[model samples]
Target: MRVKRYVVNALPEAVSMIRSELGKDAVILNTKEIRVGGFMGMFSKKKMEVIAAIESNQANTPAQPQRKASPQANEALEQILHTVQRTASAVMEPPIVTPAEKQTGRVEQEQSIIDEIRDLRQYMVKLSKQQGDHTALSEQLYELKEHLLEQEVEMQWVERLIQAIIDKQTEQKSEFTKEQIWQLAAEQLEDWLRPYGGIGISSAVRVVHFVGPTGVGKTTTIAKLAAEQTIKQGRKVGFITSDTYRIAAVDQLRTYANILNVPLEVVFSPMDLPRAFKQLEERELIYMDTAGRNFRSELHVSEVNSLLHTSEDSETVLVLSLTGKTKDMAAVADHFSKYGVRKVLFTKLDETSVYGAIFNLIMNFEMYPTYLASGQTVPDDIDRFQIETYIQHLLGSSSR
Candidate 1:
């Protein structure tokens, strides 16, 4: 391998210089700008410095004893030396000519640079083909180009995150059987919910508290669960909503409670939560829907925490929307994790086109999904946590 650096006034000139010196097999390693002192101390030029390397197959070939007076090899060496010297001299001097002459020179320089790049690309392709590493080299070149294009520092952080995920998936690929995939997903969910322990339904009546960020369908999800348990399992269901902050939110849950003929309690504070639970003691399943507040707001989170901590056995399912960015979803999960959230309920699966956020959440935060609500239908729209179904949905294999 031979490494060379060329500093010139423009990219085209630097590229041409590199090609002329390196015989069109050069691989660009790096490029940067530097200030060059010109004729007088008062004048300086911004030059582009390009570092390139060339790999020679001849370097690895076995040397054989040769007869003296091989004029062809000597002639080739002299030609190479002449090209290097000429390119170096050209790089050292700035072009000084008439405007028309300079324009023509620039056009020719650009065409030559393009030709050199094409030749180098072809050489790389031939090398890759000979070594049977075309795919690998192509992928490496693509990654190099991507890195070069990403000039933002934040992009480097994003790249690291993507790399970490790819590394984790690659490491676990061998252990990932269809059954193991399900088990792994379930275990991840169990881990996320382990802090809150199992869902408690000990008393004659059990109260499950659902609290999370706004627009996560906490009220509708609670209604769906209550309806499923009451209508399908024949369990007595009671509904309580603390969404008095919005009249429309209160009306929506009240309408659902009325249709099911289950008593609904509307509460507003931490003190109201206990009273509401006490009033629904006769019911077999009690679902408490709290007001959805901004998880990003410290004051709102603190308020929700005060209200939710009223019951030790209450299962606070952190409802997150599936239609959000991965980072935003993770932020939401992290923010709600502080409120003693045990399980996660991912909603609005039908609204999103991709499940990258879900994959990221499960892989990064290890959050277990207790339920996935896909549609707006009461009871029918909700389903128990099934990793296969979630995967199928994410992969666009499911009709549902």
Candidate 2:
């Protein structure tokens, strides 16, 4: 085999390079991300590293017709084994390093490359086993895959969901219609989400703290929840805000407090939390709003976490916005999850059509969803999260 490696900006670029140099018979042995250039590890550019190879006899052959069926499992296994052996051989070679390369963290880069190669080998094997006769799947299954992917659901979750439907088809010896496919998807999603579903803020907890990144509508969500406690439940509600970083945030919550006739206390730091709680001691339930910072940074998350110290029983809700990117929301969730913040509330639901981020965050972080705030209307727009409703939003209309 003739093996070659190309580093390019994307997979498409690498494909073009391989096609021209390695011929149509060339198969991708591995592909991974690598950082190319940087100043002391501060501003590196991301690049893709693709390794491809072709059989010696076929390297000079004319392009052949593309096959209609997926490659046989045995052929895939043989290719993966060959690649693994090649990788092992490469790893055993002696290092040929220069002084500049040593200063550039060449050793670390080499280790990263080795790790990527190992991951690629395992993934190739998984594909060989899991993706038998990929083209033979029903159109409904393909549509389901496309829909979930478009919704930004994680790839592994989508695969497992589709696999479940495929297993059902095998047992029944029949293909599912569009409606049946969507129904099965709903059932599967509900089953996965059931354990983390239907958990609202605890009534027994005297205080509820809302924390999240800036611009996620934390203060607005607090107002909504507080209105529900004060108006509907008739509980003596109080507000304590540590969001003095932004003058408008405190003013916003204070305005809501005034309208609802709930007393509002402002605390500048953790030390002031005691005084604020003492003032609201007579209240049945106190809602604390923390300053929304870039919680994606661990320092900011820890800074907010410090303000949560209290003797009263309290639960913290990691408030997220539907309009935010799923990856950024996951980062915020990951930071709060470390501090034992398991309950979540999603806001700005009406602003975005996508609902997969809610499901992704809940499933990935094992979080209990508390409420979904869909509109600007206080109390009326926010409701206790229902799995059925969320799944419906996630799947959308199935009339097609």
Candidate 3:
């Protein structure tokens, strides 16, 4: 294989270089936009970079008939030539040439060239088709990348998905339609977002905290999960609130606790966490409702971390609202991650037409959403993270 990378002013220039250097047989492997001639991040010139490669002809022999140009060669063409040569050799035998019949021998050589060139032209036609197919597949990849990006998938992940889709496309000879790309991209989506499902805890998670920015419906999500655990799953579930800063927040959770026949502990500070835990220690599942913090404040996140750290055995579910901007979600998730968030829970799935923020957070933080809360109803609104649902959201087949 011959591979080369060209950095040029424009895509057409790169293409011209590839064709001149590697001949018409060359194929583009990848292309990227780059910057050049920059001075301390000032006035940088944009450039196009392309990587092109061509495979050497594998079937050429010294005894082969001459042609102005060799067979349009690639791995596919090589295989075709191998089959044709084998079939011709097996079906016929060579005849001896006499001195008197030298002219006939010359005629035979010319005929051989004609026959080989005919077969070579067929291979060239096949090569053209292969190239066209690849170009079409590349366009499909670009579309898939755009779809993911439009849904708010981060840059690195979008590229990763494109590469994965390319591999799947190359594995099959069939043409790649949008549906095929969607299926391949969905498979990739599920693969990367691993360790996903229902909270990754049951009675085992002694202390859990649901923390996020304000208005993310964190309290409601907690109630939904608590209800499912205690009512449906029949596991002992309790609530602890560090959200005493908001008077209504405490009462809201208290109301939920009363309806579910569970305990709700309101903590004034980190010092009160131990006493709260002691009260709820007997419960199988203890959910800590932390104050909705301002991501802009490091002090707030530190306070949250301090309160949650009271118990060594604890998990934090960074609740994010799908309706929020992806930038905000990422920043808030990053800020809260200092407290050691093990999983994520996305709320308000029904509120947004864009779901890329969820995937953006997942890949950016290497964390998967454990559950999704689509509405205000307890338990019913909460769903265990389903890959198919997420895929549908990405493909724009389901509600975003």
TM-score (all chains, Cα) for each model = 0.57, 0.69, 0.63
Report the error of model 1 at residue 156, Å.
Answer: 12
Question: After TM-score superposition, what is the CA distance of residue 173 in candidate 1 from its true location, in Å?
Answer: 16
Tell me the tens digit of each residue's lDDT in model 3 across 239-291: 99988778799999999999999998888887887888888778888888988
- Candidate 2, residue 55: how far the Cα is off, in Å: 16
| Alpha-carbon runs more than 4 Å astray in model 2 | 1-134
lDDT of 1 at 93: 52
Q: Best by lDDT, which number?
A: 2
**Inter-residue clash pairs, candidate 2:** none
TM-score between model 3 and native? 0.63
Return whichever of 1 and 2 wins on TM-score: 2
For 155-194, candidate 1 gives per-residue lDDT tens digits of 4333443344335457976423334333343344334334
Which is the better candidate, 2 or 3, if ranked by TM-score?
2
**Candidate order, lDDT descending:** 2, 3, 1
Best by TM-score: 2
The RMSD of every model to the true structure, in order and in angstroms, is 13.3, 14.6, 19.7
